[model samples]
Target chain A: MSESLIPAETLERVGEVLSGPVTTVIDRREAQRYAYAVGDENPIYFDEVAAQAAGYRTLVAPPTYVTHAVVQPRTAADLRTDGLYREGTRIRLLVDRVMFGGEEWDFLEPVCVGDEITATVRLAAVDQKEGRKGPFVRQVRETTFVNQFGDEVARSRMIGIAR
Target chain B: MSTDTDTAAAAPDLATLEAGQELPPMHKFPDEAQLFLYSAASHNPHRIHYDREYARFEGHDDIIVHGPLQGAWLTQFVTDWAGPAARLLGVTWQNRASGLPGEELVFSGTVTSVDAETGVVELEIAEHTSDGRLLMPATARVRLPTT
Candidate 1:
């Protein structure tokens, strides 16, 4: 196996909640925009009347809409300093190129348009593996989303490959 | 509205779907502009999505499609099959290969298993290019209406 660029000590920080929990209200316009952007034509996501008929209190957000809301937008300073990796807390690694591996999501409840959602993110796991290209670090980040009532709405685990 | 009725009509009934039933194929041709919109909406600043030259520099033939965008299409495929009343329990996907702009991707699936007592069904899903190159391999579990 190729040696990992990230130091062993740094990789030890895996499974820690890097940043604090972030909370944001699900905006109707933003939810609609995301749905349209993804080419989802589900009426429940677009029409309030259709959502009500389907037993939702209001227009429902798409199943993956939480992804767009979980991470807060980066500020000007964050952009200047960290570049585009501001979705979560930064991990000190020696490698430069990073790519998204894949994602797994568990939906417990439907997200509505006006629900205030909070996402608590943690580095779930980390490992060094010999990939086709070379030795790379695979990091799994878990984000638990809950509604204003503190009910678990969804859980997302995203994997990133760094080389 | 008529559109809502049309969508509802398109949903598959639980009684009709068997273990080997195949979902209707969904064809998607996402162009460069759609990719840009997805990047903007997702706050993804990765130049590989919008910058063709940068993407080429990164070793891709053209701007590559986002994995999450492919996930979205898969979600729609299952949900469209299950209808609005069905609950999507979970989804897992792996980005096996890269997809480029304007490539005609066909999403299709086969019912792997069905649990009558629990009203649950499992599906093996995949998206492939027109030439049969697999792009994304996925699986999903959904709960159909008991009644």
Candidate 2:
């Protein structure tokens, strides 16, 4: 956790909220576009007919596609105001600093088109380290993906480093 | 839209390429359309990805691409080069720099070592900008199918 933007209390709070599920509906265009964006060109992701022929009734998303579902605000102030960070924060604790570090995910099932999925995130761990770059904070977040009716789909372990 | 037939390299393909042989080129350009597509595919609603104004306020010049999108592309680059007979047991990478809009990226690597008995080859691969900045660096182990 970064001491600047995220306080221990804030981290705790964020952890609490991450326990429950947050739902978002999948849109067709977005799904297809995402597949194209990744340069996957995998028909199972872009064409419903192709996906059906491949044994899926609906178009499926690439295994790592869930990263696009959560939208972050434009401003640091907004992040704080929305309770994304601690009050009067300057540095972001999520994604390591204020940006992306890295991520890893495992797909248990495909996220088919028209599936209303919910993701339940958990703060797995946070550790501080001193490296050649500088002081760094590593945070691990675990998220479980599920469909509308609550069937588990997959799990992701994302690690972010803060400078 | 690459078919398996397109990837039908001969068995022991790695045997043909020298230890330091360069992998085939894979291109990536940070564009608005690509950003939006990545966001939609990844279900990532992160505004910094497709919203320049939002990204500016967040300290980025333009929308940033999702890190995973880069990773996925990196995976594809390796899998595509490994050919149809190669089974990708695992592909992973660490993001060193963020990829923003309009930056040209190319994925390239060299064969580091090969284990013939196991049919596995180790590679040191990275995604680099046109200016030669490293974005994501990773090691990949590919196991080729034997008949």
Candidate 3:
């Protein structure tokens, strides 16, 4: 049997910490940019008047907008190089090729503009899989987002396939 | 406020949607520039998304689209049909195949179930190529307005 791509030591630390508890303020401009990037024409995400009509205090983010906060930096100059798959010691020790497998997100509440969102991320699980080409590792990172008031905004499970 | 009127006008009529109803299909042909914008907006610095040479070295014909980009399109699929009043409760999706840049991907969904009392509906959503190859298969739960 061929050896797995990820080391056993790395696999042993499945539940180890990967990134943050990183906090980011969800700006309306960023939200709109994300919406535009996805080609979403929803006025609630772009126009304040439309958002007000939708019963949001201000512009509401698109459903996947929270994802941007998951990867974005806290500040323009805060170069804290810590994130899932971002120069982390454990990630660096893993396999060579990495691909985004998929993800599942549950929205508990709408994340509106000006909401200070904090994300607590952890390496949830790791497993070795037999791919057609060779052996690969599947890593799942779970991130929980909350508002400044401590409201649970959303929970996500992102899976990455590395070989 | 006019927002209220617009909200009311934009709300999806829950009574009009039924189980097995197919939502309108959204066609997307994301080019390199659009993919770059998506990567930029999400702050993803993955080289495979931009550097064609690196992507080729990694064994892909062209730049690969971000999985989250597909997820975003699926979210739009539901929201566009449900309107602003509808709340997207959750979505679970898997990327079965790689989506190449400039490929015509069709996003579509089917109403699996609807609960009148809770005003929540379940949908089976998917993204496919123009020739009908499924790239991503997903399920979503959305809360619709009862009133």
Candidate 4:
């Protein structure tokens, strides 16, 4: 086994809330913008009548747009050299480069425009794994989204790999 | 239930839908404008997404498409066929390779399992460049309404 790159403190942070209990009301324009951006142009996201005809209560957001809707605004000054916002709680790792590994999502309930949604991100896991390339650290940030009715609307696990 | 942009796809007919059936392929031609719009919409200000020189300096062929943007396409690929009435139970994707702009990305899938009573369908799906390079290998589960 490779020498442990994950510090004890980092490992200890597992299960801790890394970001928001931030809440935002799903907006029609914003959701539509996202759909249009993705070139989705799905009727359920555009036409209310079509959405209703398709069994939706109203125009609905795309499956993964809710995650973007909850992003807390940051000023350009907060941007790092990479043009990405400086996150509040940075997970320390011995490695320097980090790459997006993958994403897993569970959509339990439909998220519609005008619905209040709150998102909370937790450090689900951080561990060292031996990969074909070398020893790498796999970190999972789990975000759970809840609707105004207190229903768990969706869950997302974003995995990051750093070596 | 496989539908692309030109054709309006509906939910799968449980009686006729079976395992080993292939979903109609969906094609996406991602270009600079689409990537830019996605960056703006997602609030991703990463220079690599917008700056070509910076991307090259960082060791990439060109300014690349956002992983999440392709992810949205993957979901759209499934949802368009599932129809609005069908609820997406879950979906997962692995970022295997970077997708550059102006590339034709194709999304295809095979029905792996179907639960008739509960109306849940499992799919093994993937996003590949038209050149046959795999970008993202994925899986999705959707619950189709009986009605």
Best by DockQ: 4
lDDT per residue for candidate 3 within A1-163, as digits (tens), equals: 5676666777677777667778888988888888888888789988899888987888888887886866745443443322134344446445667777899999999899999999877788888888798788888998889998999999999998888
lDDT of 2 by residue, B38-67 (tens): 655554556777667778887776777778
lDDT of 2 by residue, A1-163 (tens): 2244345654564454354466767777776676666776765666678777755658876555654654322455544321243433232453344445676555555677788888877777666667686667777777888887677776777777766
DockQ of 2: 0.32
The 0-to-1 C-alpha lDDT of every candidate, in the order given, reads: 0.83, 0.66, 0.81, 0.91
- The ten-residue window of minimal lDDT in model 1 chain A covers A78-87
- Model 3 residue B117 lDDT score: 86
Question: Per-candidate DockQ versus the true complex?
Answer: 0.49, 0.32, 0.44, 0.64
Q: lDDT of model 3 at residue B132?
A: 90
On residues B91-129, what C-alpha lDDT tens digit does candidate 1 reach at each position? 988888899987888888999998887779999999999
Deviating ranges (above 4 Å) for candidate 3: A1-12, A70-86, A91-97, A128-136, B1-12
Docking class of 2: acceptable
TM-scores of chain B alone in all candidate structures, in the order given? 0.91, 0.86, 0.90, 0.94
Query: Candidate 4: where is the Cα deviation over 4 Å?
Result: B1-10
Best by lDDT: 4
Off by over 4 Å in 2: A1-33, A42-63, A66-97, A105-122, A143-155, B1-19
Model 4 clash pairs are none
Q: What is the TM-score of each predicted model, taking all chains together? A: 0.89, 0.65, 0.85, 0.96
